[model samples]
Target: MSDIRINISNKTYVLAHDTEQFHHAIADLDFTVHPQQFVCLVGPSGCGKTTLLNMIAGLDPHFEGQINIGQATQSPTIGYVFQNPRLLPWLTVRQNIEIVFDDKPPTSLIDNLLDNMQLFDAQHQYPERLSLGMQRRVSISRAFAINPDILLMDEPFVSLDAPTARQVRRLLYSLWQKRPHTVLFVTHDLREAIALADRLIFLSPSPMRIVSDIEVPIAREQRTDEGCVEAFREQLLQNHPKISELL
Candidate 1:
């Protein structure tokens, strides 16, 4: 499937303890994600960005909406990377990754992925022994093991130090270069979204609705250098000063 269509008419929740209170998380939001497109959803903390991603992955199906995985008959396979590296402490890194696949993938395939993720040296190590950055790498590796049609990342780089986050972001880009998937990434950082996304979508406060959808015309290669990244940052802010309101 090359395109994913999402339409949400309404999504609401009620506080169980208080029957009179009702909360709406999303409303009348619709968007399409093209193949290999990296789309970032940015909003304040309670804007339901992660809630929307969860709906797309079928992890939470209570929302009133439609998520079509293009032409696929069965539900499209989805890979998800949560904010935390939820790795199994008892398993080796390689084993943790392998567990996702129904059948064994070629040894070379796993090896190549681990090597590219810089986890080949740490593959035998348990999650508890690895640094947080390494643990996140292994988490990413496990997600890719299934070759998902769409990958959902919910604040995957949150809580990392700047240097570690930069390393992991580069590793993510390298992996995506090898095999690009339709990606939906949720982040609160405006600059981070600007740096990583092919398309940047800004969301309003709760009862989340898209405020603006902007495309990044600059190629990823151009943004690789530190100079280019800052240049692009200036370009975005200058062109769309409204983005600053959220920041």
Candidate 2:
């Protein structure tokens, strides 16, 4: 197994704005994400969760720290799925997903993802032609099509209705099972975190230091139902008392 260690040590950030606020976004944070591990970042709003994620994605270079993946000096290939679907209105579902492929991806791979996302029937449909949930599914497909080593998801299901969100969550979990990747998911939803994470990292508000790093005890293969999800949710709540008040 490839050992994937995502190290963020003594990382501090000071805003460039007039305030010049001194914030240690991730203070002396050290966590090793083994290959194919699913990790989730859970915290209150404005907890610098996204800031930490951005640093890992190499989107914010002004921070004081080092983020290493394996032994390579260069950053790993990343695929990001944001809160909004962010699909192109001009393109069909197939075209949108295909755009992510730098070189031509295997047709079978694309087809399989479309089927898994329940987007096979809507392959020729434009973004406007699809519903919000469908568009999000397309976005998920697009992200996975790139075959990234690290997948960064920032509240990808936050905009959907409860039922739709649950469905998408299942789809995402299934895809992760098929093609295991180093995933770093950021969400305020405790249920979502418990349902998908192999390990959970809880951050404090403001400066956003790592408050808790927990290994979820549930087995991934059995986490396919709401009962199993709720069980883990309760476990998380029990472990982190602060999360209950925030949620």
Candidate 3:
């Protein structure tokens, strides 16, 4: 198995304004993420789940520790999908996705993504013309256009309505299955975590620490079935009661 061992030892962070009041965002977080594995980070609000993700993305350099991708060194090619779509209003759907590709991707690849995302008909539509869910779909397509080795997503489906969110989740899982990159997804939604992750990492309240690292035994292909999804949901609630309350 291709595994990325992450050993974050004795790492602590303090607010920029309050140096003396140290907040232990991540305290001795030691875990390994297998390559092509889908991992989820779950915790209460302000528990520093996103902070830990930022550290992995190499956006925050102040923390003291090491985050090894596969070897001892770090991996620079990382793609991020934030809570908001963050698409350019002036650009059309095709243009937005094409932006990630410096040169054009093969016409077939672009068309395939657009069709899979259900955005093919809206290719010429600008962000302002599409609904919020459509815009987010475009954002997701754009993120994958670069084909980064690692993908970091922070609650990409949190704001959507239930039906739309579920649809997007299925799309995301399909995409991840096809191109298995090292994905670290952060979310408070237990169902979302269970539906997409190969392993689930739970964090404690503020000054987060690794409370649990549970493997999701269900096969990726089986996740779309209603029975499998419901079972996973029940298991998540039973296993992580504290984390459930945060959602």
Candidate 4:
């Protein structure tokens, strides 16, 4: 795993029948993510957050830019966790995770992941039988199972209830601690970003461009404390009044 370099001059989409009508999703967006660094892309809804992730993940190649993962000739492995747990409904929890592997997966690693995520017992259950939180856990487990160089997550905790989201967040942090992969997580929620990211990259509304990149000073362990998180947020807003407007 190495640094991720991205430079996008412009990313446009056709809006209507008229050739002149176009929507610029991103413009002049340039940034680099250090290896094993956790950075959150924070912005208002529809601010091209997902589009940027798509480009980085190589899911969309129509944009005008260069996205290079590492120095190697072969592209690095990428793990993506979408907004929803797109698990196979018919497969059991364990099977869903195993399918990501082309050949036989390391049983020890799979078992460790299952034990850590508390999915060991539920591994036999189908997606429908599990709660939304459990399903998301499976999605996360599957992503990490690949041991990818980069991990891209898109609001994996958006629709969960408060407590469940908190639990999932904790579990994610724990997993990252064990094997810290380069992470680019997308979310509109500033507080959530503050809690999980080592740095926060704020973007403008549509035709999104970099507005601010603030390094988080609070220790990751201290972020769980709401008071500490709130204080950092307040201080950040005070330092950069412009960022508050986007949120």
TM-score of each: 0.94, 0.89, 0.88, 0.96
Q: Tens digit of lDDT per residue, candidate 1, span 139-243?
A: 898888788889999999898898898888999988988998889999988767767899989898889988889997777886567677678778877987776
> Evaluated with TM-score, which candidate comes out highest?
4
**107-154 per-residue lDDT for model 2 (tens digits):** 998999999989999999999999898988998898899888888898
TM-score (C-alpha, index-matched) for candidate 1: 0.94
Residues 158-231, model 4: lDDT tens digits: 99998999899989999999999999999877888999999999999989999999899998779899899889
In order, candidate lDDTs are 0.86, 0.81, 0.80, 0.92
Clash pairs for candidate 4: none
Give the runs in model 1 whose Cα sits over 4 Å from its true position.
Answer: none
RMSD of each: 1.6, 2.4, 2.5, 1.4
- Model 1 Cα RMSD, 1 decimal: 1.6
Please give the distance, in angstroms, between residue 50's alpha carbon in candidate 1 and its true position after superposition.
Answer: 0.7
In terms of lDDT, the poorest run of 10 residues in model 1 is 222-231
